[model samples]
Target: MSPLVHSGPRAPLRWAACTCSRDPAFVVDPAVQLVFKHQGGYATLERVEDGGTSAHEKNEPRFRPYDGRVHGVLYRVTREDFEKLAKREGGYVVQELQVQTYDDSQYNALVFVSNPLFKLPQEVIPTEKYLARVREGARDNYLDPAYQAFLSGINTVPGAGLGSEYYNTPSKYMGYSFLVIAALITLAFFFQH
Candidate 1:
């Protein structure tokens, strides 16, 4: 069976947006020798606000070559589901890595990592809402207790959920453009009356 490793928000069945089977094949360890670095912030696609576009930076799970290991849940997926997953995870690069389950069993699974070219210069703290999803996934999957604690301890930018005050604010020029368009429409309406 083909397998996929989910170490982040997608670890929880609830947060998993993929159409794969709801149940995990098994929880596994050594998903990779790579260190789990949750700090890397990447720019999501541009969000439009007030007729202007702004790209929001958000923290996402990524792995790097380090001395530690990443533990995660392994899921059995069909070829169609795997293709859908690959499409959904367009921002990430996929690699096949070996993972071991609790019974010391091993399977080759596909793991996703943020593309290095898209990584931000400095780390951005994840939002509380985002962290909650990650926490829920780890808890739901019964990941390593120490790893769960470490995940819990990571600080978040309070109230930084999407479209919150922390996200893209319309530029002054966009604001002005909106006002000008409104005024123009109002003038046109009056002239037609």
Candidate 2:
């Protein structure tokens, strides 16, 4: 009889955001890190600035200009993990909040754990191949070769090197060229006299 092998299903995690009011006004800056833990491991949290409008809708009772919300980054984790993290310290109950006027605002929150409805592909092509394809596509689309060359030159320039300093420091070469020109001019003047 052949031995049986089983692989457990992957967990589903939805990126979410939460907003709460602080009695003492707090300065929320962009790029703050948030962390969440699960049975398997902990996932890093990402904070995105809530734009001009508040997270809640204007008509909603919870809506407040002073209130702030932290946006989460996209990731995949299990529902059980999410619940466990939510119940632990620093976990806030996911709730739906609305914001008016901002059409691109994300409102829905994860109220309960559920099965992952989507799965992302696992295999990724090598970086070199991917970039080569981008370059090929640009060539196919009739991108300007001169512009591409200019970008390549800019990217190729090293910040610091013997050759780079020799080329970049025009003052050194300019002074030498000026001296040669002055000597040639002086010789011509003497011959003319």
Candidate 3:
């Protein structure tokens, strides 16, 4: 039987703004910097901000001295769109997208940032094509019962649970303690003799 699909109203996009630094001295790096920019832009485009300050506000023309730091943006996107983008461009790794919501709202805006490993492309692939490929791949490889059983086996081996068995066993010091107690008893017996 096909997996149960939960159908519900689409979620709104949410967004936030943040600043990133790339200098070695700075904790934030180029990858993080791009994420801030992307997320900020995405949020602005969605217009999810109604009563709160946004990363776009800080980047406005009037707000001068925009060092692109100490500012970041966040927002949300449709699950379908997120999945499509993730498959097409190695998902969020190629373009890290951060999203958050303020209270409860109709739509959400997400922050888009460029990953240090990959620069944001001027032209983005459409979400449809990416999702199609992902679906195709899943059908081809992940649906096999054999493959699923193999994966389950790998995941359920003993001693693999919660790390190694040694973690639960007593330490060598405990053995030494028993030995010391035995030695003390022997000495007492000799004195009684």
Candidate 4:
């Protein structure tokens, strides 16, 4: 589940908005900016064509070219947190990726991708609530005005489950405490048997 879609607690992350090529990219080990996506994981292509280039996807948009960069945020996470995030985003599979910073710096990072098995039939418009949280976050972080403007005009529905503030504010710590308590209880029950 996307953080925007979840009404539950937020996963902790230190992140910043950046760009990633929407085109095919591969992940490689090195300190330099990578021009590719990791070959072992699922592809994030918005659409695929018939054997166009990627063995990863079968169908692609007939006439459109996907060789541009799109804005995305990068999260720095620990291995444990990475696992938790993947589990939380029911459809996401985690993979290590190399991303280029605005200054041309590169870092190996963990990214969450939608499971190909569950990808939408066609690229669907992002939900209003989803767009709202992104806007709120951009504002909160004082992201580049150009990027904020880009988000402002996107189509959206009315206020969703919760407003965009859910993304701006820190999620409740109580939820984590509850999860820990529940895990202990489950373990105790199993051991007692």
Task: Identify the candidate with maximal TM-score.
Answer: 1
RMSD of each: 11.3, 24.6, 21.6, 12.4
Q: What's the true lDDT of residue 169 in model 1? A: 29
Global Cα lDDT for candidate 3: 0.29
Tens-digit lDDT track of model 2 for 1-193: 0001001132122222212211111113433322111111111223335654221222122211222322222222466755654664232234332222122433333432111111111111113332343344334433345423422221111223323212223344566899999999999999999
Scanning candidate 1 in windows of ten residues, the lowest lDDT window is 38-47
User: Against the true structure, what is each candidate's TM-score?
Assistant: 0.52, 0.18, 0.19, 0.48
Evaluated against the true structure, the overall lDDT of model 1 is 0.50
Off by over 4 Å in 4: 1-68, 158-193
The TM-score, computed over Cα atoms with residue i paired to residue i, of candidate 2 is: 0.18
Give the alpha carbon lDDT tens digit for every residue of 1-193 in model 3. 0111111133221111212211111112222221122211111112223554443244322222223222221213456655554554321343323332222222222333333323321212213332243234333333334323322222111222222222222333456689999999999999999
Error of 1 at 184 (Å): 28
**Model 4 Cα lDDT, one tens digit per residue, 79-152:** 67556557766545766667655546666666665554444433323456555776776665454566567557
Predictions in order: lDDT: 0.50, 0.30, 0.29, 0.44
